[model samples]
Target: DIDPELKQTYDVMNRLRETIKNRDWPNYNQAFHPLQGCSEEMLAALQTLAAHHDEIGNTFTHHYTNGPLEGSNNKIKVIKRTGFGYRNFFRFRLRVLFAFRVHTKRALITK
Candidate 1:
């Protein structure tokens, strides 16, 4: 059986996820309602959530996300790590461009 405190955490998180998915801003604010005599960790999480309220709401409100750019950055980091760092700036730039190039179609093999 899950602990009561952990269940509360999950329930709060699920509510937020559903709110964002549904773009229900009103309920999003409701999720941050004050709780008394809660665990220290939950209190800390509540503070963080309250701080980033606007940023989180803006995700669904604007329909803009940096997911694609973040993916590209991860790919570039992998290229650098696999090559153990490149000595030339031009070479690194070209490698990133070639990896992300959408003009050419190539089937990648997955293991």
Candidate 2:
């Protein structure tokens, strides 16, 4: 289990769904909603967060800030490194395609 403070932080974040519901903020950073991806669910969650902000009177809300894309990019770099000595363009293309397929499929299933 996570620590109480960590859980509290998470709870606070969940509460921010309401905070973002009512405002016309241009950016999620102002409300600290890091998980506000460009998805419908994220937009809805932001709307909820805005509404909650007004209810609770808390000005500063927070969320999961960073994306895993950078990590995935790093992994791709590693894969490229592993294929560094490939002489044929076709082999390189195959390696990259296979890596992308494996990574994206795993990410989708995990999500």
Candidate 3:
């Protein structure tokens, strides 16, 4: 059998996941407060989360994320890696532009 403390820790983590998944902002404090004494690592994480409580809670209020920008960044990384890096910044910029232009054209054609 697992240790009692470890089981409790798992329970807390599961509850926290459920709280976030359900966007239960009002019960966030109740869910998180118990972690302050769960373990040193959990306590430290709790402190950090408390510090950014507003931002964390904002996820429930806002339905947007930086997904598109992150996707673009990933694409740029792939381009840079595949080309083995570029010596000229202007050429790199043009390549990035060209890549996106081709992507857009292909998307339009497929539609």
Off by over 4 Å in 2: 1-66, 102-111
**Cα-based TM-score, every candidate:** 0.64, 0.29, 0.69
lDDT on C-alpha atoms for all candidate structures: 0.75, 0.55, 0.78
Instruction: For candidate 2, write residues 19-95 as lDDT tens digits.
Output: 45753344334445444233455566557755775543434344433468887778768877887667876666567
**Candidate 1 local lDDT, 20-105, one digit each (tens):** 77999898899767464446787787799889887977875798888999988899899999989898876776677678773433
After superposition, the stretches of candidate 1 with alpha carbons farther than 4 Å from their true spots are 1-14, 87-91, 102-111
RMSD of 3: 5.5
Higher-lDDT candidate among 1 and 2?
Answer: 1
Name the runs in model 3 displaced over 4 angstroms: 85-98, 101-111
Stronger candidate by TM-score (1 vs 3): 3
Worst 10 residues of 1 by lDDT: 102-111
TM accuracy, model 1? 0.64
